[model samples]
Target: MVRASTPSTWLQGLDIPSQLFGTTGGSDYELYEEDDEFVLTIDMPGFETDEIALAWDDGMLNVAADHTDENRGRKKTYHRRFRFPKTVDDEGIAAEYTNGVLEVRLPTADSTAQGTEIPLEG
Candidate 1:
């Protein structure tokens, strides 16, 4: 599913029942900037790396996961989106999942422009 830049905007119209079956549900996540990389940590227990999907488009980061609890005969879906600030380098983003936590790293914008000197002739 496509998501807007703002996460709350898409969560307002959530369908609870459908979400329990196979639709997107609200998921908890944390975003922070540290050193040269922006970090995003999301809680997604009971899901394998292959069952999750991620996408970055138009400055919006989208994450979705689906899994079935066969022992309980229940299915669940978790989804979230974040609007990255212009300071992020979208092209260098990377993700890794370990011990049920998904961590994404987004490098800071290149500094080449910051050091550029423009000459003015008036």
Candidate 2:
């Protein structure tokens, strides 16, 4: 019996796995740093206000959206993900969905810290 030839390793490198997995979606994100806080603007079209969920855990911010059955009859698939710069305080963190866009506001470290500074002298 004759043996089959294997494809080159370089061919695998050129493979676009995101397209094959069907996780590709269009999204725009903007991160801004202010004196008291950092604001994150995420663009999520075709999503409802109640279907989005945001959480902070283990120095990471997680955002997920679950579409309802209203579009179940249509052929659609989405698997987009966004990673935040730093973990935010889960308390008082609010998410607002408007006009098919999700806006998440995160308070900075300085804003969350309270108390007086200690003086050191030598």
Candidate 2 at 69: error in angstroms?
A: 5.7
The TM-score that candidate 2 achieves is: 0.55
What's the TM-score of each model vs. the native? Answer: 0.66, 0.55
Angstrom error at residue 11, model 2: 10
State the lDDT of candidate 1 residue by residue for 1-122, as single tens digits. 22224334455588444445433333356677888988888878899999999999877889999999899999989877788766678889999999989999989886556556789999
Stretches off by above 4 angstroms in model 1 are: 1-27, 111-122
Clashing pairs in 1: none
The model with the greatest lDDT is: 1
RMSD values for the candidates in order, in angstroms, are 7.2, 11.2
Instruction: Give per-residue CA lDDT, model 2, range 59-86, as digits (tens).
Output: 4667777675655664323344445445
lDDT of 1: 0.78
